[model samples]
Target: MFCSTELAARLEGVDTELIIAGSAAAAARRPGGDGFTIPIAGGVAAFAEEGSPLDKVAGLGFAGVPEPAELDAIEARYAERKTPVQVELAHLADPALAELFTGRGYRLVNFENVLGRTLHDDPATVRPAGIEIRPSDDSEFDLWIDIAAEGFANPDTQGVASHEEFPRDILANAMRDITAAAGVQRFLALRDGETAGCASMRISRGVAQLTGATTRPAHRRHGIQSALLATRLGLAKAAGCDIAVITTQPGSKSQQNAQRSGFDLLYTRAILVKD
Candidate 1:
């Protein structure tokens, strides 16, 4: 129900689907460009890759996530050929689905945490503690990637790599390209000329997605994130955007910042991992 149009655009360009398996719109793989509605039962018994053109059944359906047997069937469909597989659906309705794949020999790897808050176009932008906010240029890509890896606490130093393996360079390139195309605006918070923290905002169809809110060790509790968030929301207001969404952990500084910046909770979407 909450799909980003920018995501739809990127998926169209890359010929990929996000695999949203759910009860309301189950067994329907909404095509990238135009969409279609799927009328099926069993609450998304499976989510498979698009094989042909989707039907124009309201164009708002979901991908039928495959079971272990279904995945095996699909894998066997290609045999020796390898394919990238990703699933980003609800963990409640089909909680055991990922495990089924792992039991069938599919390696479970990598994860991402998501948070969101509705956009307020009239919030005040306050840059407390002398924190500076500036628009970043193309040269900041590698730095952004580096900071991201650091923020994520990744030790590999593997720059911009996807969750999957194979052609590391190619995946990194794809990651950069996708992130670049998200129309994300980056702002770096500086403390006496050093990078204190950074935040990225992606605006699409009157919805603003806030991500990559990170602060350096020495810059914690200095109101750096507060300034950055206020500034970004102010920019969104000036640009006529209506909603801002951000995701953060419970009791985290990022959560506090969002609340302090006048962001109210809309909903929470969780990512369930296999132990």
Candidate 2:
């Protein structure tokens, strides 16, 4: 059910491997993403892009890597790129089947090391910084986009802001409409009256998504990101969210911050390229 770019983005610059949904594979490489695509197996396939010809898990065989002919079949049907991709075998997948993956030079990057926690029980603590937190309004869209571009990453790049544009930018901007109508808050942190960082969250249906936290290069070591995060946690608790779900890089400064702020690591999803 996962998209290839989604997996690739999470893995980031590691370049180990990427798994993908066939739909995303069909979309030509996204300039700032994994650059490869894979296909989904079931219901969520509806969400996958149309016209992908990749096979489902069953047809591909949960037993092991497919036979040479079968693998050739997947390659024939999967036409978005020339790169090879791997099918992730879940923990429950038969061991014999998993060996096929191992035999084919595909290594399982165990993601269990990543963790998550519920925010409902977290106690907020005040931390000191010369940061001022305020709401992000439509008028500040440029600042918002700039901050996102500055904080988010682009595949195959160095330095945070040195990244390129991302596909999620379009999707995220669309969701802002829903949050805007509900008075869900998006906050910006400023150092000495200039924007230093930004974070946004929405408490809805008892779920608080700690989304979009960023710190400008000049603002690092100043506690701007942490303050914004703590503020978000307080907001979630005040609004009565039962849990917060954050899916960031398995290990990054942002991911560590989330874990430290009472967030727990959930199992990870991956994207892998076989060849």
Candidate 3:
């Protein structure tokens, strides 16, 4: 029998592991800082390019309650790397993990809301007219990366923009690494033959995670993002995924669009950082 809790746990585990794997892959293509993984209390911490914008320990989760010894070990690992310890904690994670981080001087830095919806046979039926979504090709890779970078650079979006100029080389390298190793499916959204946005889907453990959904600033409010979401969901369904998930900042335009597209709020995850 498939229990809801069991399913949630499974999804959470795979989601974190996938992030770790993707980060390590991207770090390998960089010049310095070899990405590595450390066994933590109940999960794993993946360290990527130290000091780079992409650098962080991902998938920091602990099973049940964590002891002080476990917290010490985790901190020691990050200290050895000379990088601040950062953890993105899922809402469904053990409550003790948050308490331990708070007790250890870790501050909450980001809050991300996870949304999900069951995949239907014709998930793209809701796609807006005049917008076309298709699998991205090698020739379109640069454009896709550029669009994504621009979208993320918007002040309205979360996260600090490292540089005003697009980090083209880094973005290209990371995209190549992730595409080769993460089983990611990239899609480009076009409005009447012009590139409007980009989205990606990574399927694992019978679930499809929608990520990197972004629209060019000039293309906002035209339903491009919602159309991309529908297209990705359709693709995931066709690929045999039972459910599709996405994450966004709470109460943001992205979250509003997601809710309008029939996705329900699953939980909100927090990013904890120790400097």
Clashes of 1: 21
Those runs of model 1 whose alpha carbons end farther than 4 Å from true positions after fitting are 1-86, 90-121, 154-175, 273-275
Off by over 4 Å in 3: 1-4, 30-32, 51-54, 57-62, 155-169
Q: lDDT for every model?
A: 0.47, 0.49, 0.73
For all predicted structures, in order, the TM-scores are 0.57, 0.55, 0.86
lDDT of 3 by residue, 1-275 (tens): 12254555666766666656667786676557557666554556666554433445444453566567866876787788787877778767777777878988998877777788887556746567778988997788889888888887763553432222336566666667667777888899998888988988899888998866888888888889888887788778888988888877777788888878778888777878987
Local distance difference test, candidate 1: 0.47
lDDT of 2 by residue, 1-275 (tens): 12233322222211111112322432333334323322222111111222122212221222233455655555454345443343433333334545655665655433322333555476576565567887888778777767766655432122122211344454354335334443446688889888877777655456665645777776776878678877777777777875565545546677767667776654443323354
> Would you give me the overall lDDT of model 3?
0.73
Against the true structure, candidate 1 reaches a TM-score of: 0.57
Candidate 2 is scored at a TM of 0.55
Query: Model 2 off-target regions past 4 Å?
Result: 1-115, 153-185, 273-275
Candidate 3 TM-score over all chains jointly: 0.86
Q: What is the lDDT of candidate 2?
A: 0.49
lDDT of 1 at 114: 35
Kindly list the per-residue Cα lDDT of model 1 for residues 36-93, writing each as its tens digit: 2222212211222232111111111123444445445444433322333333332322
CA lDDT of 98 in candidate 1? 49
Superposed by TM-score, candidate 1 places the C-alpha of residue 166 at a distance from the truth, in angstroms, of 15
